[model samples]
Target: MKKPGRFLAPIVIAGITVGFLASAYKFVFSKSESSKQTTSQPQDSSNTSSSSKNSN
Candidate 1:
């Protein structure tokens, strides 16, 4: 029983660690996706100004 508990402890810890890493990854991925969307689509006036500035 003691041996079984020891083995289970490591497994439980690993599962919790994996879950935490996965959630962090998902949060970062979603943030990057949102950033891409925001950057790809700009307001029309700001878009023109940016383009004109680059042309100079």
Candidate 2:
């Protein structure tokens, strides 16, 4: 029983670590992609606004 518990402990710890890393990577990747989209769209909008103001 004690030997089984010791073997199980490392497996459980490894699984938890992998899950945590995967979630963290996903969170960071999504945030960067969203930032890229927002950044690109804002530049276009800012240009349009500036052009409209000049036209007026």
Candidate 3:
């Protein structure tokens, strides 16, 4: 019915919006974390050396 479609429109829009916002949060946090690690290092990028992969 027309009424149901009107109600569904907002719900669909909200779901899409939440999905986009969640992805945005993930991307920003990941970039921030990478920068944080770089800044936290004792020396600058010039002194960097090769490292080995760890299993963890």
- Model 2 TM-score is 0.77
Which residue pairs in candidate 3 collide?
none
Candidate 1's C-alpha runs over 4 A off are: 1-4, 44-56
Candidate number of the best TM-score:
2
C-alpha lDDT values of all predictions: 0.89, 0.95, 0.78
Over 1-56, each residue of candidate 3 has an lDDT whose tens digit, in order, gives 34567778889999999999999999999999999988868454434533322322
Please provide TM-scores, in order, for all candidate models, with all chains considered together: 0.62, 0.77, 0.60
lDDT of model 1 at position 39: 81
Could you give candidate 2's per-residue lDDT for residues 1-56 as a string of tens digits? 34566778889999999999999999999999999999999999999999999999
lDDT of 1 by residue, 1-56 (tens): 24567668889999999999999999999999999888877776688999999999
**How many clashing residue pairs appear in each of the predictions shown?**
0, 0, 0
Between prediction 1 and prediction 2, the one with superior lDDT is: 2
Comparing 1 and 2 by TM-score, which wins? 2
